[model samples]
Target chain A: MAILSLAFKSLLNRKLTFFITLFSIAISVTLLLGVQTLKTETKTSFMKSISGTDLIIGSRGASSQLLLSSVFHIGSSTNTIKYETYQDIEKLPAVEWAVPISMGDSHKGYTVIATNLSFFDHFSYANKQNLTVQSGSIDDDMFAVAIGADVAQKLDYHVGDRIIVTHGGGEIEGHDHDNIPFFVSAILSPSFTAIDQTLIISLEAMEAMHTETHDHLGALPGETLLDSDHHEHHDEHDEDHEQHAAHDKHDEHHDEHDEDHEQHTAHDKHDEHHDEHDEDHAQHAAHDKHDEHDEDHEQHAAHDKHDEHHDEHDESHEQHAAHEHEDTQDQRIARLLKLKPENINAIFVGLTSRHAVLGMQSYVNNFQGEPLTAIIPAVALQELWQFFSLAESALNIVTTFVVLVGLLGMLSIILMSLNERRREMAVLRSVGARPSHIFGLIIGEAGFVCLTGILLGVILLYAVLLILQTPLANYYGFYLDINMLTSNDLFILLTIQCSALLIALIPGALIYKYSLSDGMNIKF
Target chain B: MINLTDLSFAWNKQPIIDIKELTIKKGEHLFIEGPSGSGKSTLLSLLAGVITPQSGDISILEQPLNLLTASQKDTFRANHIGFIFQQFNLLPYLNVLDNITLPCSFSGIRKHKALSQSKNLESEAIRLLNALGLDDPELLQRSVNELSVGQQQRVAAARAMLGSPEIIIADEPTSALDSDNRESFIKVLFDECQKADITLIFVSHDTSLKTHFKHSLKLQEINQATIKEAV
Candidate 1:
């Protein structure tokens, strides 16, 4: 105890040099622990990006590329899967639920994902946790879009604000879907995953936004729009008209499923258009007779006529009755604008049982409708993490070298002080301190400095982590937990402390020899 | 009492100390004076058991130091001897009280002896400081570097005289003191040694200070190595 106190006082006497050495060690320790934490947390959050899903199926390509594009939003898929193929997979016996996703659109640098209500129902991440809406509820309206927490915060979007989406991943000239802007209907809570940086809308809205008829629809004459009865009637059959117009204009550019559906729909619609043209003239005459009704009442009258047409044609009476309960003008127009999806980028699949994942993966790989690839998310994440292991090891090696440099600095400081402390050692010897005591004093001083340095490093790491938490989650979707100190960290700290003690031995031995030779003789 | 017989010591094959016989009775104050490099410091090192003689045996308090192992010699030195140097006698890092009590921290016998005199080591250090004519209460806690040279020598005297060691070997302890301070410092040192009945061996290159001691010898009279170097 006395010798330790003496060592401490001696270091206190040389406060500037000692504190500089201590600060260098502390900084090195912070870098080491910081790198370690980044490596571990990144791997953990990366693996947690998508979980609880049995498999992910996409157009035949590299599984890693598919995972990166679909789950991480890092790149684009090479090809798209036919919507018919997704329907087939959804109908498989082993599949519990499957959510189809359409990508290749962006809203101000944030990816826009086109999915259905099934995505909100079935998608889970980070231990089977579901995405939650923060303020508003998800609506079935085609133009109603839900944004993630990060998207809402970054773009400053609210529930009613409308945003224009670009056709591809970037804002290319003439590719903005300005005619069909999407309004934010819901904002999702933070999931600490890629979902937190995305804009989600129904696939039907995505189909309508990309169709050429909507582009022309936005440029319709003002007189046509002012004619309320005709405009409402025109909005009622807008989906069919857009589909037929797209089929007639760009038949070869669509998928085989879309062409086949278009062919059947075009024949039915060709006859229906002629019949509906006369019926629409009759309805216009009837609406003129009821011209005493106000504009609001006139919209209700048009809805009643639309419901009558639905009863006589393809839709059921019960469906029409259900629509009448919540049929606002916007909802009515949204229903008309919704179209069936022709193709999708990928599908996230969930199974009734975990044991069936491998079997389902093989089934998806051998799918006959079109070439497809399916992968277990966990396995693919592991493979991806292995690719990062080399970088992780390189980082660790660099930090380890930094710790070495810190220890070497301490060693050099101690060695230099030894030259000036020979008289002190002789004084100690005269007062009956053994050579072993001198040796212990040096080692003890180093141990003390190193232990304090490590503690300071931990404190500094936590401070930095606390300051960067929100920015990291907002920018990179990295959620760093401050309270996580694994046994691995303890092991590394222990190794550093032991190495410090061992390194102190160099100067300890030198001073020990000096004390022996200079025995009781004040050399300086 | 201290005794040496036929002691011979060499430094890098050059004889630095060669003594035929030396003895000092209990409680005797002896002064050994010599010129610089005339083996005064070397003789003190040999007497303190810090270095072993290559040929002869040194027995202090009837224990043969040559027969003891290096570590045991250290323990024996700690228990039986106290040392004072010319200047910088106190470790600058410790306070005046801590400097005076330092020997008690290393030696169990000295600690027991100090405890027997006072309630604890601090009071015992105070008692020694008071006897050495440094009664300032604030000076006990002040850093040793804050003291004047005379006060620093007094603190060194207190440390060497604490726990009543049998021998006090002071190497040119008065060389750095002024003429009046040197006399007063020698007076207080002799008073402490007489009170404890300690045998004092004071070595110096200054011959004027030898008048203060009853028994004094010059290195040329007894050290053949220095005489031979002179011839």
Candidate 2:
């Protein structure tokens, strides 16, 4: 303790120089720890970007390539999965749900995803946090599309604004879907995932745009939009009578085993039911018209006290009944158009039970008619990281080098200051401090400076994280949580402190040697 | 009491110190005069138990210092010796009291001796400071840097005399002071050493200070290496 005080006093005697030295160590330590934290957070956000879904089914090749292209929207897929194959796998009993993703388009720099409305229901990220529409609604209209939070922020888009997706790559292509421009029906809230960088549209909407010529795309946008909007209103009418009419879209797709011939069979089954319902409804309509005067006379008495005129109310009621009969015909045709997905690039699958995941994975991998790959998301992500571990290792090497340079600065500072401290050492030596005490003095002082530096570095990193969290999340979709320290951080801090102690010993030992050898001030 | 016999030291085989015999008893004040580069500081380093003699032996208080390891010699010096430098000897960051009591922390003998004379280390330091004519209580808590050169010199002297070590070596300690402060410094030093019965070895090139000591010697008379160099 006494020798430590002496060392402390010696340092305080030269406060300005030592303070600068300490500040240098603090700055470099911040950079080193900051890099380490960024690496961990980046890896975690990447992994948590898409969760809950069990498999990503695409044509066979490198799993990393598939993961990058499918989940991260980076590069391109190895091959597209057949839409026919997708429908078959979805039919399997082990499957709970599936989202077929077909792509090769972008809005500005953001990727454009073609998926069914079920994607808004089934797609998950950041661990089961579902994609939520912040503004507007997810409609079934083919031309209506939803934009992600980051995409909307960057493109300065709002609900009802029309945008077109580029046809080929994100950029470097003049061809764009200029004819069938999409209106933003919804804008999603940020999920800190790949979804934030995507513009999502219904699979049929993408198909509809592709089917049109560039000139025709914009020409008939008004007519198609009106038709799709009318279809949406009619579908809501089924919700009012939902108990009888509500059919699960999944069951409709699941029970049918017929392939390309499925359209006729399914349409006939529905057509027969509609015919029977129309006959019953027509008979009721004729009977209601005959009794219309009598019914209005009784209803008029009931509503006469509530409103001024009875004829006005009767006229509105008759018009609504007439419209309802015509709307059902439009709905039947629109419902048939809902199942028009011809192809998809990849499918995200969730098994009926967690245990069924592995069995179904291999069955699909060695699938009978064609080669395919079914990847367990967690395991595939792990493999992808392993393949790219070289980059991570390279990053590690750079941070370590930076920390070493910082420590060396600490070492050199103490060593340079030794010249002026020689007389002080001799004075202490004269008053009973041994060469070892002098040694401990220098080492202890160095350790103190390093420990302070480490603390300052950690605090500085968190402060920067706190300040940048919102902007990064809003613009880049990187939601950095400042709380919690990973084991890697703990290990790095421990290593830095240990190295501080070890490095201090070098200068300590050198001074001890000189103190032992020479006379006053110990010329070496 | 300290004794040396046939002591010799060399720097790169060039001799710096060559003393056949030298003896100083307890409570004796001796002034040793030497010119610049006469190995005066080298002799002090040897006597302070920092470096061993190349070819001879030194004994202090009946203990054979030549046989002790460097660390043991360090312990010996910490317990028994005090040193006052020409200037800038006090550790600047420490308060005067801490500077005075520092040696006791390194040596249990000095600590117990210091503790026995007063209530604690601080009071013991105050007692020594008072005897050295620095009686101001506020002076003890202030940093040594706040003191003037002469005051700093007195604090260094007070530190060396704390716990009343058996030997006090002053290496031109008054060289940085004005003549008036130099006289007062010598007076206070002699008075404290007399009261505590401390053996004093004061080395300086100034021969005028020799009259104050009971016994004195010139480097050319006692040191064979210096005589050879002079010839």
Candidate 3:
């Protein structure tokens, strides 16, 4: 014990060099622990993000792609599944609830996901945690929309705001459903899932937005004639052209572009203004193609054809944009609502019982009618985690090497001091210290150096996390949890300490041999 | 208190010390003189139980040191002998007081004997320091590197005499000091040895210091094997 104190004093006597050694070891420890913590947390977040969901089924394609597109809103589904298939699956005895999502739209750069009220009831993420509407209630309101916390925060939108949906999923530019914008009905709280980054709307609204630009608005059965029919579906409204032109002129906001082509946006705004006052005209105005959220893969008319189609839509924009301004109040209220969804990107299926999942999965995968694929979310996620584990191990190896270098530095530093300390050793020997004391003293110094380095590394790790906590959680949805140390982290620390002790033996043996050789009479 | 008979030693097959017989009575302050490499330190190492004789036997305080194990000899030396080096005696990292108390950590018997005389180790260190004319209480906490050569020698003396060891060995302690300082150092050393009735085996080439001891011997005169090598 006295020799141990002597070792400590010996370290303090060389304080500057001691700290340098401490810092190197601390840096190594921080790197090792940092890599370990990130790997575990990433796996945790990934597993938790897709929990509670049993199966994700999409039209015939890669299972990983299907999982990515359906749950994570990444990539595109291989093929669209028909609405009839959705109905058929709902009728299956093993099916508990089937919520269909139709993608391909964006609102303020946030992906819009179109589904029904069942989504609000069945969809769960992050350990089976249900989505919560922080502000408003869920509904199937055609013109009503619910936005996720991220979408709301980033776009600065709130409930009751009118926001137009974009035609595509990836970017916000190009054609938007400005003609028939939906009112934000609710804002969902953050759930640390893909849903937190999406906007939600009703399936029928998605259908209506797409069907709004079609020429078949007035040609339907018994009376699918839109609200604009009351104003005359014939060419009599040609006189209203000059008025619509004046409205388009008033709608222009950007500094660029020719006034002759209003891009349909200006006209929609002016037309809505006119519709608000001219109650009769509002009843049957044509609203250009309104869009939905599930899959915003709106096949555009190509860049060169965009102007040509723009001119065509400009001609029809008068008929449709004017037509929908009034249709919002009339047709929507007339109970002429059931616009059957033609296709959907993916479907989330829940089973009546856990046992029914395997049977239903096979049944869906082998259905002769249409090629399809089904995947258990957890299984697919496990496969993904396995791939990530390779990188994690590689990262761990690099940090471990750093720790080794640090330990080696400790050994070398002690060795360098050995020459200068020979007389100190001889003096100790003459005072009756045995070889064992000298051996213990050397080993004890090395061990203390290592422990100090480890504790500093851990403290630095926590410091960085605390500083980056809010930004990471907000932008990346990574909630770094601070709790009791994981078994793996403690194991790493133990490994470091044990390895340091082992390394000390090399120098300890050297000190022992040197002491016996020098005896009480140091040559110097 | 020390005996050596037919003791022989060599470094790399070259004979260094070959003594037929040598004996020193208890409480005798023996001054051993020698030139630079006349095997004085080697003989002291043998006497201190640090290096066993190559052949033959050595006995100290009625125990056969050659018969004991290396660790046992180390323990035996720690309990009974105190050593003052020529220079660099005190460990630089420790303050003056800690250097003096270093032996008690290894030899529990010495620590208990020290405690019997004082309240604690620090007080006992101070008491010995006071007796040796290095009574500056402030110097006790200063690093060994900061003290003057004379002050350092006194600290080493205090360390050797702290636990009342049966024998105290000084190896050229005055080699670093001037004439005046060396004389004062030997006087204090002899005074402490006399007070404790300790056998002082002091090695130095300074013949002037020989007058301070009760007996004196030249290392060459006693080491007959070294003379044979020289001839």
Q: TM-scores across all candidates? A: 0.85, 0.81, 0.84
Model 3: per-residue Cα lDDT over A1-524, one tens digit each: 78889999999988988999999999999888887777777778778777677888789888878877887788864378987678788888888899998988877667788888788888998768889999976644466788888888888887777777888764545678654578777899988788888899888777667665344433332233433542331233432343233222322311222342354453444434443353322222222121122121131222123335444565555433422334443234221333546688888889988988898899999976688888899998888677777788789789889999999999999888888888888999999999888888888898999998999989988987788778878887677766556898999899999998899999889888888877777656
lDDT by residue (tens digit), candidate 2, A211-245: 53333222221335433433443454432122112
Question: Which 10-residue span in candidate 2 chain B carries the lowest summed lDDT?
Answer: B222-231
The candidate 1 chain A region of ten consecutive residues with least summed lDDT is: A278-287
**Candidate 2 chain A: 10-residue stretch with minimal lDDT:** A239-248
Q: Is the docking of candidate 3 incorrect, acceptable, medium or high quality?
A: medium
DockQ of all predictions against the true structure, Cα-based = 0.68, 0.65, 0.75
DockQ of 3: 0.75
> A264-352 in candidate 1: lDDT tens per residue?
33233323443433222222222222333353264445545554575466544343232232233332333433455678999999998
Chain A TM per prediction: 0.79, 0.76, 0.78
Q: Could you say which candidate leads in TM-score?
A: 1
Q: Considering TM-score, which of the candidate structures 2 and 3 is the better prediction for this target? A: 3
Q: How would the candidate models be sorted by DockQ, starting from the highest?
A: 3, 1, 2
